[model samples]
Target: MTNKNRNYKPKIGVIGLKGFPAFGGSARAGENMMFYLKDEFHFVVFNTNTHTSRKTGTYNGIEQIVYPKFFIGALNTFYYYLRSTLHCLWDGSFDVIHVFHVDAAFIIPLLRLRYRVVSGHRARPQFAAKWSWLVRQYFRFMEWLFFKMPADVITSVSRPVAELFQTRTKRKILFIPNGIVFDEKSEILQIEEKDYVLFASGRIIASKGVHLMLEALVKIGYTGRVLIIGNRSHSPEYAKELDEISKSLNIRFIDLIKDKQLLMAYLKNAGLFVFPSYHEGMSNMLLEAASARVPLICSDIPENKQVFNDDETFFFETGNSTDLAKKIEQVLSNRPLAVEVAQKAYERLKREYNWKILAEQYSKIYWRLIETKKPLNSGDSEIQGNDEYKAG
Candidate 1:
């Protein structure tokens, strides 16, 4: 964003999402975009030092503006969002301020007059059980504000979210699902076929339904190993509870997997990958599993259904542990069916979920906004209500 060279590329400031060297769906999405779009745009990502302090520097060829972590939960998110938005506004170097999540969308009205803002609606955080009633209400208000606020562009990571935004705002929305950067040369873990491991990755929270997966495994009397990878610090109480539960079941929980090669190996070699999340904007883990060619099973949520449409064999009733157990058993016992599903998922990932294609779509959107707004010299009045973008 700060580059002023005559040969300068478009500068994009990404806010309200974790930066490089972080975990979770939002972080992964941000990282993937940065990886693919690094050459086309100069990215400046704002990283909140809520968990640990990271110095401001270039991470993976993109600028990282580190800010000290604040309070926990929605408060922390709002604080970071406000600070990041203010930083971008004051810097005046960012041509496009791309914001992620609905909470961050609260700053859209303030920035629309100055910078060309792209609001990415990742998920409906209002429904997360972790937040209190008041917090949820505040989030709902912010979501409402997001729809009402004028922005250069609006994008969603899943079809359901894109449709919801289109239905609510009556404006075109970009439907760009999260993608996986498949590692072709990573050493696959030599997990024995007889191990019959079950894999799941995400924040260890109730919304993710890791507890449900555990219950399902127990119900099915699955004696195989279960590997759950994600940040436990997200929900310490839930993680502790899961730890206690794991003591009685054949499950192992890895709090954080920093090694990409090892993580890929686990994903590539897992007997089955199960995603029992209750909600999601778009599950990066599901895409990763599919890319890794893991036989998949997930809860029958609209989000998951959007990705695996009519593939009812891989979905179980949401929140039903018994049904999930049955699906797990079916996948494990029916080797031919598992192979078929895994191969189909791999083909789909290669065809649709590659980051290279997704990045090009995003590049086009950014360029169009840049050209349409010409923010360098355009006045506020000239930019407002210029929503000429249609669905992509």
Candidate 2:
């Protein structure tokens, strides 16, 4: 453990499932947290994907150890965490260990005497329902094991997730906003003169509700183009179906977005950005839309409203195409109001959602937790063995 104002920067290690060029909000947030606190902390980012071979390397002055893969086929995810955790446990130079998910967070128990911090990025019953009953039970077991591990602090992206942790454990939970770096060129909502009124980002998957957006477009009588830019890596079949639906509805679908700048340019010129996801921890796509000054019409989830203004952004009922279509029509009819809302939302993002600020906050937490360990109960030593303490 090290003091925040110490002369020497503490060596901090960040572990994540995704590797460099960090994908999604988790990777982006992890990268930003490391970079923002680099002045006071030496960041060592261990990419779970490259955890192959015993080769040790350095990345931007940070120590990196590449571990070998143990599994080649279906057990790739299990092998990834096993290798990553073994490597981290072997090398004991890190002052702080921050894990993105609880899949392998159980490793922290062995280092109970050392400083450790775990983040519950996706340890919810709702997310677990994707698996079969037995597999879901196994996941619940793993989560409980991780929760019992001796960690100095915990962090969650949204209030719902934070509350989830509070209900299960006695540790102090912090609600940190996912950090975002908005493109300056697209940060301001320019009244782009356009006829199109629909936009969506991320993988073209059924869970993402792209089809719902397409159906909503059809209902809105939008004879104009509908741009859906994202990676087709996750779901090719879903993408094909979406393309077919778009064709049937006479809407245009942009297959992929290779360049981020170009993607932001498209969002900047669009009439509105629509994200009709079934559920989310916190969406990076909606944040990008806010940064690009695009009027947002998203699912009325607790996560969406946490990022954007309740009044500025139009919220459609989750999984309801009719509601989404009506919201889209409502926004299109009032262009001036939509533009004003977009401007306000952009300003809010700039003030509250910047990665740099979030990084600073994370850095402070790391320092505070490292210096003073959270007090434990005298009777709590045997609490970890209790089956009743297991995560749901």
Candidate 3:
């Protein structure tokens, strides 16, 4: 490997996501990273299937490699990872192989190439209640195996996750929090006549605590419309239960929205944005709400607390519907306090959670890893690093 100069843009192979037009936090993270860093590096994102007419050879300027389609389930994800790994290994084009989630961590060991490996540990998948006993055990095993696997760098999106990995494995981890971008030109969706509207978005899974949100709404006798936008495929049974509960409660369930502008409109027009997740690596939805300057009420989980303090957000007990209801009531009843909190959150997002800032943070990490793998020459320029390396 020769020394890379300032102009040398590293080729990065991202191995995660079933395909393009993907959903969920992990997919968005990957897409946003590529968007912000495409000019700085050459990216080739791997997709499972591309038979659709809209499937293109590239997204933005990054290349996309499409593999044969697989069945929909955990097995499909495994197959996608396995196939993508083999392709990257054989092609030998990437300077770094960045895996986006813990499930793809096991494949790191099999990539016997000169390329560096970087993986993201999003959350404790084993702790998610939607998974069956067997599936949870498998996730637990994978979680354990992930730390043991050979990776040049491991990152977690939240301080809590970073601390857990550091404590358990005795290895340094990069804490690169998630970020949000607002579309200025996006048309705002008008909220109809309502005293209050509470909006929440994410995968409609048991761990997300949508049920708890619903229960809180019921307990408080909220008269306004409730909008929940998310994919329900992961936990259909739980979603059905939520559906039954929402019929009399004026709650509207919207499937995963593909349009960023429309989603932003929802955030912008909402009287309040509530996040009742039991756990998270870091919430993109919460960051978006903060970006849109929406008054926020979220569970007091470590991940949520990492992004917003008590002054910027109202905290409710995790999984406690009564407490959540009380917090919601407090925010709705007090308009001035809500506006103050929303302004603080928006300021915090500007100072800390902008995508450009996060992209620079990630660039530093990538350069550090790349520099470590190369032989240090006297003439080589050292990568200017940031203080994010100093763990708390």
Which candidate leads the pack in lDDT?
Answer: 3
What ordering of candidates by lDDT runs from best to worst?
A: 3, 1, 2
Which pairs clash inside model 1?
A: none
Q: Candidate 1 on 242-309: residue-level lDDT in tens? A: 77766767776766665566677778778888888898888887887788777888889998887775
Q: Give the TM-score of candidate 3.
A: 0.89
Model 3 worst lDDT window (10 residues): 383-392
Candidate with the greatest TM-score versus the true structure: 3
Model 3 lDDT per residue over 239-346, tens place: 888988777687777787766666776777788888889888888888887888889999999999989899999999998999998998898889999999899989
Candidate 3 clashing pairs, residues 3+ apart or interchain: none
Residue 68's lDDT within candidate 2 is: 50
Give the candidates in order of TM-score, highest first.
3, 1, 2
lDDT of 2 at 366: 67
lDDT of 2 at 69: 48
Give per-residue lDDT, candidate 3, residue 232.
89
Where in model 2 is the C-alpha error above 4 Å? 1-4, 48-71, 110-115, 122-138, 144-150, 182-202, 250-259, 375-392
Checking candidate 2 for backbone clashes, the offending pairs are: 51-67, 52-67, 52-68, 53-67, 53-68
Off by over 4 Å in 1: 1-7, 51-53, 71-75, 187-196, 240-248, 310-313, 374-392
Error of 3 at 329 (Å): 1.0
Which is better, 1 or 3, measured by lDDT?
A: 3
- Lowest summed lDDT across 10 adjacent residues in model 2 is found at 383-392
Q: All models: lDDT?
A: 0.74, 0.66, 0.76
